[model samples]
Target chain A: MTDLKLALQEQAEDVDKVLDDLLLEPEGPEAQVVKAMRYSALGGGKRVRPFLVMASSRLFGVSEASALRVAAALEMVHCYSLIHDDLPAMDDDDLRRGRPTCHIEYDEATAILAGDALLTLAFEVLADEETHPSPSVRCALVSELAKASGMNGMVGGQMIDLMAETRELGIPEITRLQRLKTGALIVFACKAGAILGKAKDIKMQALRNYGHDLGLAFQIADDLLDVEASEEETGKKVGKDAERGKATFVSLLGVERAREQAHMLSEQACRHLDVFDRDTELLRAMAQYVVNRRS
Target chain B: MTDLKLALQEQAEDVDKVLDDLLLEPEGPEAQVVKAMRYSALGGGKRVRPFLVMASSRLFGVSEASALRVAAALEMVHCYSLIHDDLPAMDDDDLRRGRPTCHIEYDEATAILAGDALLTLAFEVLADEETHPSPSVRCALVSELAKASGMNGMVGGQMIDLMAETRELGIPEITRLQRLKTGALIVFACKAGAILGKAKDIKMQALRNYGHDLGLAFQIADDLLDVEASEEETGKKVGKDAERGKATFVSLLGVERAREQAHMLSEQACRHLDVFDRDTELLRAMAQYVVNRRS
Candidate 1:
């Protein structure tokens, strides 16, 4: 296996352990919600976002424990979003990662409560002193993550995507939507290391730029996979975007053009890592991997 | 009007203005979600939670601006819960605060996103430096609020409540459910003032004790109202508990006995304020008002 693949696997396992330790089973009538939380959160996925956090934090020499806590928190938010998005009132999906969605596995109300609890837990984890010795750094992390996931970012992007099902979106509109939906969280993950290390503005900017390009490339690649890959390969239903008439990067730009654009963006993303003199090979490889992967 | 009534009215108006200013209308495809958030958050309610926050903060001489921000954040979380709980898969309510619920006013998808955004915004507001000068204090506020609202608190209580629809619950079970659902947030509201003021442990304990009794009284009052009050008076569908055969305080205890319990709890709640020789007339009056309130 390639070094990048091995590192990603290791980071994913490390984050999974942190999440497991943080989310303890509750003994109560409401244990159902906690069970649902564990079901969705501990279910295996690529953990790409957590890997970015670990890789970015590694660049700044952040402690493994601290980075892992932040990664776990990020994963919690991601899992919560997925749970809510899969509800009957939203995307209404039955399957995620080849398993029943939270609402399908548990009842809808339980899934909703679990999602709400998980989101709340993410903030709680970030605010805890165990996440970082410095309160200011923790507050910064909380604020950044909240902003990235809140109305002006991921949630807002999802709102747009929901609306886009009825309307045709051009390339620029699709790009903006994807940026807000997935790109904001990616940018926050990359910049989290800088906040943890108290890196200078220039370094933070470099990571931000790298994350921006990489996130776009990643989304484009996802769009391509939805068109080219089967449900077995993707571990999710494919061609839902086309079925819904949703405008994605691939739908706006033809398959060949979208693939070319993703490749170009991946290369451009790697160029931003030049600002860091050492220990960025993992991030560089990640950019290539994100665009090249089938899923 | 009585002094407590006057104070509650004034505080409610203050919180409304703060929430309005904080939640600005967005200009984009996602504006629908923002509009839904505003509709639900700005919709007229008693704003009792914000009033509790203001009253508690007044005990510590906390800055009004800081207190207002915290109060607004608390209200946002409350509003988010209401929105999500009223969804088709949950409580399935069409009306809230004398108007259509968020999902009824907007699409279900939009309401869900708006709720998610509002919850995210709550943490963002608390973590902002404007909420507190010290980052540690902000972190504390975030942690406390998250704990109060997350699983094992409000959300857990909700899970239990949902489960109780199919199962019979005794007085003890009902009391525990109410404590987690509504009592935890009220306790946090009261304790938030102590945290902001950096009050002594004894004082914090006094407020916590007061909040515990007061929250129980409030829920009992709500249950009584549901059983006795009209839909117009309550601004929501009455007898939902009985309609669904849901277990509640009123169901376990006779109506007259439940009312008596609420009144006793209110008086007991006020007794906790004896520790504060200062101006606690508002809190004392609030306790009485909570039990006697028709809606």
Candidate 2:
């Protein structure tokens, strides 16, 4: 395997460990919801957002423990979104990450409660002193995470997405939708390190710029994968975007143009890291990995 | 109106204004979710949790603006729970506070997104500096709110509630469930004042004791209403627990016993407030109001 692949695998294992620690199953009937939380949040995904958090934090020489806490919190939020999105009322998918979806594995009520608990847990983790010694930093983490995942961010994007399913969307509308739905969380994952390290404004801006381009490139690649890849490789139901008649970058730009755009965006994202004097090879490789990977 | 009733009415109107300002509809397709949030969170309910936050804060001389922000955040959390609880997979109620429930007002997808947004916004409000000048206080608010509402608190209580639909629960199980579900957030609301003022540990414990009993009294009264009250008076469909064959304080205890229990709990709750040597007529009256109110 390539160095990027090895690094990604290592980080995923590390994150899985932390996630395990944070989500201990308690002794109660409510343990059912926590069980669902563990099922959906563990043993899956590439941990892309976590990778962004750690790689960006590296630039500021942030402690591994602090970065990992934030990374796990972000991942919990991401997993919660996936659980909710896959509900029968939403995407209605049976499979997620090659296993039954949360609603499918557990009952719909349990799935809903699990997702709610996970989202709430993410905020708790951010607010706790273990995430950061400084109260201001912890508060910043909580505020930024809430904004990225809240009304004008992920949830608002989801509202737009529900609307998009019923109407044709142009490039601008689709771009905005994708930004809020997926890009906001990714960008927050990148900027979390800046808040923790108290990085300079200019450096934080550079990281944000990099994250914006990286998020778009990642989504475009995902759009392509949904069209081209099978469920075995992607570990999720594919081509459903077209089936639902929802607009995506692949449908709007065509696969060839979309591929070119993703590659160009990936390179631009890497260039944004030049603002820092330190090594950012991992993040640069990540941008390229996002566009070039099969899944 | 009686003084207690007038106080609840005035606080309700004040909370509604704050919620109205907090939930401004932005110009975007995403505004659909915001409108749903506004519909469910504003112009509804007695704002009992907000009342607890403000009344408790009055003891510490916390600024009205600061207390109002926390009250709004807590009310937002309470409203979000109502929206989610009334979903098809949950309680599936069509009416709330004499109006169409969130899912009835908007589509299921929008309702889910709106509830999720409101919950996230609550955390955002807590984390912001406007809630308190001290980051420590802000962090405490977020942590306590998340703990009260997350897996071990409200959500966990909800999980047990879902299970209660299938099996009969005794008083011990029922009390534990109620404490986790509604009681946790109520406790958080009352203790939020102590957190804001950085009150003594002993004083905070007193408020907690007060909240614990008040929450139980409030819920037991609600159970009695479900059994004896009408839809018109309660502003919600009555007799739901009985229809679902779920165990409740009223179902387990006869009406006479339940009524006595609520009254006893109310009196005990009032006694807990004796720790403060200041005027606490509002809070004292509130405990009685919760037990005796018709709606």
For candidate 2, write residues A7-92 as lDDT tens digits: 88899999999999989998978899999999989958999999999998898989999999999999999999998898888878
Candidate 2 lDDT, B1-295, residue by residue in tens: 8887787888888878878888989898899999999998884788889999999999999998899999999998888889889999988889999999998988888888888999999999999998899999999999999999999999999999998888879999999999999999999988988999999999999999999999999999999999999999999999988888888999888899999999999999999998899968999999989999889
Query: Considering summed lDDT, which 10 consecutive residues are worst modelled in model 1 chain A?
Result: A244-253
- Give the per-residue lDDT digits (tens) of candidate 1, residues A1-295: 9998899898888998998998888787898888999999999998999999999999999998999999999999999999989988788898899898999888888998899999999999999999999999999999999999999999999999888888889998999998999999999989989999999999999999999999999999999998999888888888888888888888878999999999999999999999999999999999999998976
TM-scores for all predictions: 0.99, 0.99
DockQ of predicted model 2:
0.92
lDDT of 1 at B13: 88
lDDT to native, each model: 0.92, 0.92
Off by over 4 Å in 2: none
Error of 1 at A226 (Å): 0.4
Interface RMSD of 2: 0.6
Residues B49-146, candidate 1, lDDT per residue (tens digit)?
A: 88888888999999999999999999999999999899998899998898989998898889888989999999999999989999999999999999
Q: Specify the poorest-scoring 10-residue window by lDDT in model 2 chain B.
A: B39-48
At residue A284, candidate 1 shows an lDDT of 95
Itemize residue pairs with steric clashes in candidate 1: none
